[model samples]
Target chain A: MSLLVVGSVAFDDLETPFGRRERALGGSATYFSLSASRFHPVRIVAVVGEDFGPDQMRVFEGRPIDLAGLSKVKGLSFHWKGAYGYDLNEAKTLATDLNVFADFKPDLPANYRECDYLFLGNIDPVLQLDVVRQMARRPKWIALDTMNYWIRGSRPALDAVLKEVDILLVNDAEVRELTQEYSLIKAYKKVRALGPSTLVVKRGEYGVALFTPDGIFAAPAYPLENVFDPTGAGDTFAGGFLGYLAWIERTDVTALKHATLVGSVMASFTVEQFSTERLEQISQDEVRNRLALFSDMIRVEDL
Target chain B: MSLLVVGSVAFDDLETPFGRRERALGGSATYFSLSASRFHPVRIVAVVGEDFGPDQMRVFEGRPIDLAGLSKVKGLSFHWKGAYGYDLNEAKTLATDLNVFADFKPDLPANYRECDYLFLGNIDPVLQLDVVRQMARRPKWIALDTMNYWIRGSRPALDAVLKEVDILLVNDAEVRELTQEYSLIKAYKKVRALGPSTLVVKRGEYGVALFTPDGIFAAPAYPLENVFDPTGAGDTFAGGFLGYLAWIERTDVTALKHATLVGSVMASFTVEQFSTERLEQISQDEVRNRLALFSDMIRVEDL
Candidate 1:
């Protein structure tokens, strides 16, 4: 199965309670590609610039990710710097250099148009809707991740995109913020009314919850000893999630539930180090080990 | 299968974002008995004063709970005043008058002495241990709930009690504080090393995690539209948990998991109103309704 992911591809400087790191290979597309590549061949559509180096390219070199759709524009790549407090859940943006990313017009490769699965990472909701319009054929499943920025500033565009996506992925707070509903159940029902058949609420370090018309299933965040950085954990979650769905060739409620578990396992690795440091080096065995942990963390006797 | 609950029976004044109530029926034992009575006849060992009236007793009067161990002493009943912020998760104690509960002693009724299950509510650890020693027959399972106050101020007594208990129930922050470990996994190991066969780390609103020698299991908090007041939610959880065990006539791991579900159902009701207002008026059908909701909330098919 082929998977298409569109979002930012850039560098990040992040600091957390565990430690700090300088400009590292980061961005939504980078983490998404790395995580999704573990399960299926991924096609990345994003714009990077001159600063996008060979070292970063090597991160995805041998993987089955096609960068034909990844553009190398002029000037510096998008750069973001952020710091997290002890909570490690909320990030304060220190700086953002959009660079070439400011004019990012995701132009999917001709071959990418027919990908079986699509993931629109956190970006402008209007742009996300445009990408969905560009797809040659309707993918088996289309999942989206969004931020408070769009939900607050571009409600119409977000609502437009929500009406088209098969799944909506968001953090706990953003779901509450978007729906103005404090209770998750009510918020989920409101999101569902917007058109997505499935809603996945991401709770950092806690777990993920999946809401489908059929039922609701939740999986706890795979417990970790240390969280070095939380940047891109959400996108990495989306990568593993959609990637697993493509790998299994199923988007039923059952597959979505299993995909939530896979997403949690991938996210646990993403937080162990800054950006994609830990995620880039994770092996299939490592993924399997974490999936085992996920199973153990959520296994309860039938009551 | 009789159950014994030893804790305070008090009057409480509470304020929440929703509203406020004064001199409401509240306390660890009050919530515990009201919830546990659903499964088995609960023998409550607690101290109240003249201030404790029929209005308060009415909360438990019709339930299958024995008041033989409830004592009324001189002066006012233990009085507590608290308020919850918009989050409804954090409680700020405005006032605490221990009153009769300050110098109280738990004298288990002769009929309660042979209870197979014991739930030691949040109270002085020394008093908790004293009740254990006074039991005519050793309970098959003894679960203890504690807070940071006792963990820091009464470590020795708490440690002694921990050695004698079968399970330890505490909040996530309390577990982190008690073990000085940032990760719940490490915290669980440290807690298990202290002697309990099982450990439950409760994350308010997020859900609860159970760690046993065999593995880990988790259940998300049953989502609700509004939380009027959170007082006594924890003890009510304990009551439902232990009560399920007594009802099933077993304390095995399977029973523990079922108890966790019952606990979640009970807590969903506790948060809906102040003190035992919602829990007091809850019916068997209401319990089943919430149980079905809990089931719907976590139901997921394997990929």
Candidate 2:
């Protein structure tokens, strides 16, 4: 069975110390589908404007991604312009024209509703909840990603969605903000109580921390000499993780660690270029080799 | 075999989100010795003052640590007061009093001269160079740790010593500062070029990363529910690492990975309480079990 991803598909104008780009193909589902498509078949439900031309949307054409639920509206596509300086962790928002995405009411198609996997990318909790309600058959596994925006603006809605999902993708600071706890372990416990049994806190460049009732696991990011643009790196990470889990058809302890590393590897590739350039072009052999390198890098034999 | 640790032994007043403590047994050599002494015998070469009374100095007792080279002067011991806000990565120094430590010329005891492993903690680079010069027999493995202060203030001296060291233990920021490079991998390469064949960049709370001429390895910190104080976590890490190498009598690729995890485990315990209270009392079984847990956390089978 395939994975169903619901989030924004938009254009991003980005600037970093390395260079700049204007109106590149960007957004949560756009990135997630591309990265996840590398491993498992992916379907996206997102809204785009008429301005988002056929050529701009061709990044998903040759991949195992179904755009059956992608909506092309009359207005401009959701557009965001941002910049990064020394610290790639924080994005400086130059402007955001959420013309089409502002009215994003996710409407899942028939095939989409029957999928076994679902990813509610960073979006309005109300919309995320609506998609959950539209599913014809409950997915085997569902992971949700939310930003600080919905947590502060729509707590009740966020809380309602949290109880249904199997995992919540959060950043270190956002986790603290969600639970009002400074300590991450405390934050992890509090966050799990809100919804998902599996909580993965993305720590930007440092790495990601995984928490389950069984125990906790921390995974480091693939160390890079340069990070061109950190934009969409998180979504790409989710894509890798969910994609791997979908491919393996298991979410056990070993699979969780494997997924976490794949997520980090995908994210490392995502930041090496603007938009999904690296993610789209990454070969299976390159991924296997890189994963092997990572395996060697962190290998430990018990004493 | 034992590790020779050279640095200050001081009193620390610390404030963190967990709580506060005053003038507790602190300093680089003190923490390193305490942590390393658990695995292999550790000989400390540094100076304290008469004010570091019997009760205050009793933390080192009942431990496999040699104090033959630890000097006691007539004046007060070196004192440092620091605070950690929401961001535990940075230790905001509120006070620093270098009393007897100011005149410390590491007069290594004759027996200390034949050591195989040497760890030079964050101190004046010039003093570090002097210790290297005074060694009766060059150590088999010499790792160096220097602060941003010496990097900025004593660049030439730091450079001179860097050329002689086997490895350099740098925190992420100090490496960035030393090379004027924001990218960690690039910074690691630049630091390696300056000296030391091996480089380990310590990312607080995140993890410790190791790089040799061979390849790179990344190890995550042991997840802690609470990081009571991060004062000497890095030193403890070095102690565990170097001490383990001393015990195993190896620094091969597998050995380096093993040492990295041991370092992470030791640092984890150090952060659980103020000063070296946790490190001073941890059992071998506890270390073995914790290391095993970390081994499981980062485990990945070859793809």
Q: lDDT scores for all predictions? A: 0.87, 0.88
Comparing only chain B with the true structure, the TM-scores of all models are: 0.97, 0.98
Worst 10 residues of 2 chain A by lDDT: A294-303
For each candidate in turn, the interface RMSD (Å) is 2.0, 1.9
lDDT of 2 by residue, B1-303 (tens): 658989989999999987899988899999899889888999889998988888966888888888888889899999999999877889899999999988888887788878789999999999899888878888899999998999899999999999889999988888889989988779877877897888899998889888888888887788888778898999999999998999999878788888998999999999999887888788899998998888877776655
Which pairs of residues collide in candidate 1?
A: none
Cα lDDT for residue B43, model 2? 89
* DockQ, prediction 2: 0.67
lDDT per residue as tens, model 1, A152-256: 999999999889888898988898899888777788889889988888999998898788888777777887778889998999999999889999997677788
Query: Which CAPRI quality tier does the interface of model 1 achieve?
Result: medium
Residues B128-203 of candidate 1: C-alpha lDDT, one tens digit per residue? 9999999887888899999999988999999998888989999988888888987877888898888788998888
TM-score of each: 0.95, 0.98
Residue pairs clashing, model 2: A162-A195
Model 1 TM-score, 2 decimals: 0.95
